[model samples]
Target: MLQHLKDHSNHEALQLQLFASTGEGITLYELESGKETFPFYLTKGTYYIRIFSNDQPMKYSFTSSFSKGDNFENELNNTKSTAKLMIPNTTFTGTLNDGGYDNQFADVDVYKFEL
Candidate 1:
């Protein structure tokens, strides 16, 4: 299960908290080899995810499959005004600290797509 989860780029979060899932279990995961995953045993229903941290910056990505994708490019995109344009149905990788980190503020990445 762990191996399957890590393979999906979409299965990631930083110190994540999952709740109100369709089951009786919520697993905690941290970044390992650029991926994070949880137990994938549950019914299809409403789910809640909450991410909070005082020390570590949040980093996350998602992909439908583990087979193909492109690595995220770092371009100082910290706001909506400077959001990186993305291609539809394409996958990319990135991290919070990739931009830069400051104890006073966490790094933020912004992306946008056309209609």
Candidate 2:
């Protein structure tokens, strides 16, 4: 299961996309507004997750695989400028620049881990 939270109540809704590892370039699931994806069985392989806010210019991506008993959690702020991904025994925090094309802030940050 995947879960998310925002700092503000009136923030733009969040978007999520899931992809398989078959390299077929197809999306497995797409969701919005913090809704949880329905429980589905998955094979043992790599999977991709993409997250972003409806009105923000930044996007975040992650990769994971199915395990015996694993839980995942993701947290983001309303501005879509900060995020945290948590898994068993590991946590990754990311921050992005609000400047879309102006380069006012540094580029977005991404962290990858294997479990």
* The best candidate in terms of lDDT: 1
Misplaced by over 4 Å in model 1 are 1-71, 98-101
Candidate 2 C-alpha lDDT tens digits along 12-88:
55555445676432233343434364343344567665566666653333334444532332222322345323455
- lDDT for residue 9 in candidate 2, whole number 0-100: 57
TM-score, predicted candidate 1 vs. hidden true structure: 0.34
lDDT, each prediction? 0.48, 0.43
TM-scores of the candidates are: 0.34, 0.33
CA RMSD of each candidate after superposition? 16.3, 16.9
